[model samples]
Target: MARQHPEEPTLVELTIEEVKAMGKQGIDHPSTRPVITGGVVGAIAGAVLPVVTWPVGLFAGAAIALYTRVKR
Candidate 1:
C-alpha cells in the first residue's frame, strides 16, 4: 500500500480594488485618449473625405483604438 502526501494551500495576493481594476484599462485608461482622438478625427475626416475614404478613416480609427488598448 502507498501513503499519500498532503497538499499545501496557496495564497492569492490581489486586493479587491486591484482585482476590479484589472483588465479595465482597455476602454477608460489615459492610454485610450489617442483612441478617442482618433475616433473624433475619423468622424470629421469621414464627413469631408470621399465615401471610400470615410470607411478607411473609420477603420484607421478603430486600428488606433486597438493599438492603444493593446499597447497599454
Candidate 2:
C-alpha cells in the first residue's frame, strides 16, 4: 500500500467510523430497520409485487421480516 496522507482521504479511504457517521448523520438512530436493509427490501418488494401478487410471496416476505417482532 502507498503512504497514507497527513491529510484525510480525498475521495476514497473513508474510514468505517466516518462512513457510519456519514450514513446516520443528522438522523434519529436506533432505527427499527436499518436504512440500507429497508431500502433494499422496499426495492425488491416494489419490483416483484406487481408481477406475482400472491398472499404470501415476496412483498409479504419482506414486509414480515421488517415488521414482525417476537414477544418475550
Candidate 3:
C-alpha cells in the first residue's frame, strides 16, 4: 500500500493574509490606482448625458453607482 498525504487547498480558499506573503500588491491592484476613478469625472458625465428628463441626470449617477457596485 502507498502512503497518503493531505490534500492541498484550492486557490479560492487562500485568504488575504496568505496572498500578502506573495507581495503582489500595487498602488491600487497590482497595476496602479483604482482603474475606476469613480469621482467628478463619472459624476459630470452622468449628469450631462441623461437628457430624457431633468431627473434623468440623477438616475444616471445612481445607475453608475449601481453598475460599479455590481461589477465589483
Please, what is the whole-model Cα lDDT of each candidate in the order they appear? 0.58, 0.46, 0.44
Which portions of model 1 miss their true places by more than 4 Å?
Answer: 1-23, 26-28, 53-56, 65-72
Q: Pick the winner on lDDT between candidates 1 and 2.
A: 1
lDDT of 3 by residue, 1-72 (tens): 999998865444443333353246544342122223433345566566665443454445554543444344
Taking all chains together, the TM-score of candidate 2 against the true structure is: 0.27
Ranking by lDDT: 1, 2, 3
Off by over 4 Å in 3: 1-53
For model 2 the local lDDT of residue 31 reads 29
Q: After superposition, how far is residue 11 of candidate 3 from its true place, in Å?
A: 24
- TM-score winner between candidates 1 and 2: 1
Best candidate, lDDT: 1
lDDT string for model 1 (14-63, tens) is 22233244348755755455656776778678879776476678767855
TM-score result, candidate 1: 0.42
RMSD of each: 10.2, 12.1, 9.3
In model 1, the worst 10-residue window by lDDT is 10-19
Query: Positional deviation of 23 in candidate 3, in angstroms?
Result: 39
lDDT of 2 at 67: 39
